[model samples]
Target: MFDRLFFVLGETFTALRRNLGLAFAATGTVAASLYLLGGLFLAYSGISRYADGLSGRFEMRVFLKDGITVPQIKWTAEKIRSFEGVRQVNWIPRDKAWEKYSKENPEIARGLENPFPDSFKVILSDLKKGDEVSERIAKLPATDPDGGVQYLRDEQNLIAQAKDALKVLGGMVGGLLATIAAVLIFNAIRLTVLSRRIEIRIMKLVGASYATVYTPFLLEGAIQGALGGLVAAGLLALTHRTIGEALKSFSALSQLPSLPYNDLTLALSGAGAFYGVVCSAAALYRLQLRYR
Candidate 1:
């Protein structure tokens, strides 16, 4: 079995050398497909991380009605902290608000009366549940005697919905791209097999087992796929580096997480090798059916 495997490997290599153009074409196609996929994955990862970071800073300010004492404030804080998904309840005093506002807007600080209200800054574990937190906060016993606790960012729902929609759309687009690439790959492999029918038939007539004849084609596809993945990985790395250089001054993009060199290399290399192997196997299987 070991000798047979070596023989098949040598045959596959020879075939690849003989049909170098076709092999290169297959590799190029696979590389392009994998590159697009890797880019999408990279973008998704960055966006996901960004969203998570933003969610961590998500907080709802609950203002107290007039005449509320420290006891009432403590009660309200305890209730909020006990609620589901409530990570932490920070009580921002009017003084701290004034200080922060003054520091942020020093010009307006001069004549501005302490318009800051005593507010309970409630932080939630899940940003998606912001609306739930706001609703629960408003119903707090001492939230507001006359009026309710007003949400500063009432548009959070709209933003969350938008992000969810974009995620679904991205998934759909990725699936479509993958399907198209697979069909193209399958057809390309079939054509390659058809062109080699005479040689394959001769081998079978000379008593070569189906497995023996099958190995070389499978190996060829595997090789092409691997080469393609490698090319795509290189291209993606270069593209990212160039973009990083250009956007080095942009603080936001600079802070975004990117794939480390080792991870990217390994993933792309494995993907390429796997694609080559699978494409070769599939093509060989289909071609063998016709001969049998």
Candidate 2:
């Protein structure tokens, strides 16, 4: 077994050396493909974190009608508090609301009556139940008929749509690059097999098993893939560090979550190796040995 392993290793290296240009091309393609995929993963992760952060701060505003009485306001607040997932209900009287509005928009608030409605700022424990909570609050007797319960539903929907679009676009691009890489790997292995056809036939005639004949090519492809993955990982790490440093001066950008570099490296490397082995196997399968 040890001798066969040694032979496989030697043959693998020999073939790689003999087809250096093709091997390089295949490895480079694999690196580029995996790098692109890794970048997408990082970007998606960051966007997801940002979305979660925004969702955590989501608040529903229940606006009371203009002629709403104090008793009606109290009953409305009590009913909202009884709702599932309701965390806190803070009252914002029209006077205080108007004060804040005036401070923020002095020009607009000048010489205008307090147009702000008395409202309840409803905080939720679970963002997923936002729509349910909003619907219940909107049906309350004191809720304003014009604009009753308001939340960041439109903003949330936009974020969700953006995430979905990113996933679709990433999948399409990643798949195309992966297919190109696989084809390059297949062609590289095929060229190596063709170059050593005479030696392969002689080995077959000397009673070499299929495993003995094919193991070297398989290992060669794996090596190429692994090298490519390592290169891509290095590039990703460098980019992450550089961008992180550049964004440090921007407070908002710095708050974005960091990528899991260790996990990403392992995933990329393992995926590349597996992809390479599959492509090599495909090439060998298509070039079935008639000598056997």
Best lDDT among the predictions, by candidate number: 2
Candidate 1 clashes: the total is: 6
Pairs that clash in candidate 2: none
Q: Write the per-residue lDDT of candidate 2 for residues 1-292, one digit (tens) a residue.
A: 9999888789899999989999999999889888888887777777777766666567888888888888888988999999997888989999999999999999999999998889999887656578788888888788987778889987766777777877887899888988899999999999999999887988898988777788889988898898888788888888888888888889765454666778878888888888899999999988884556
Candidate 2: segments with Cα more than 4 A from true spot: 65-137
Model 2 alpha-carbon miss at residue 61, Å: 2.4
lDDT of 1 by residue, 5-94 (tens): 888888778777767776776677677767777776776666556656655455666888766788989998999898887788888888
TM-score of 2: 0.78
